[model samples]
Target: TNLEKRELVELSTRGLSRKEKLIVILYYLEELTMKEIGLVLDLSESRVCQIHHRILFRLKETLERMREDLLG
Candidate 1:
């Protein structure tokens, strides 16, 4: 679990755009709601939701690949 957390921390920021990084930090570290995040970022709430979904998807895919590489 620790390793997973560490990997998430590392992967979440890697090669991310400024907006992506801000979204991650605001949502995870700052515990901001999507609506709040959208307001902070000057994006629509729906767009913020989309970004959050995409970010989670990307993280899941990346973590799966890392797990495969480690095991195989």
Candidate 2:
């Protein structure tokens, strides 16, 4: 499962923009390459990579925040 899907399953609601969600689903769930995602999304490969990184970083941050909230 994609990170966002897992997060969404656990959290029920995702706090990301539409593009971020689409990127996550394509990259992780659909198992698409950056080039493939770019082609499908009408973005450049470099832009897809950037979006992937941003989505990953955002998910990580949200997970950390959730952990802190749970622990504290």
Return the TM-score for each candidate structure. 0.82, 0.77
Q: After superposition, how far is residue 53 of candidate 2 from its true place, in Å?
A: 0.6
State, as a TM-score between 0 and 1, how close model 2 is to the true structure. 0.77
Q: For model 2, what is the error of residue 3's alpha carbon versus the real structure, in angstroms, after optimal superposition?
A: 13
Deviation (Å) of 22 in candidate 1 = 0.2
Those runs of model 1 whose alpha carbons end farther than 4 Å from true positions after fitting are 1-11
Which candidate has the highest lDDT of all? Answer: 1
Output the worst ten-in-a-row residue range by lDDT, candidate 2: 4-13
Q: Whole-model Cα lDDT per candidate? A: 0.86, 0.78
Name every residue pair that clashes in candidate 2.
none
| Candidate 2 lDDT, 14-41, residue by residue in tens | 7777777777777766789999989998
Q: For residue 59, what is the lDDT in candidate 2?
A: 78
Residue-level lDDT for 3 in candidate 1: 72
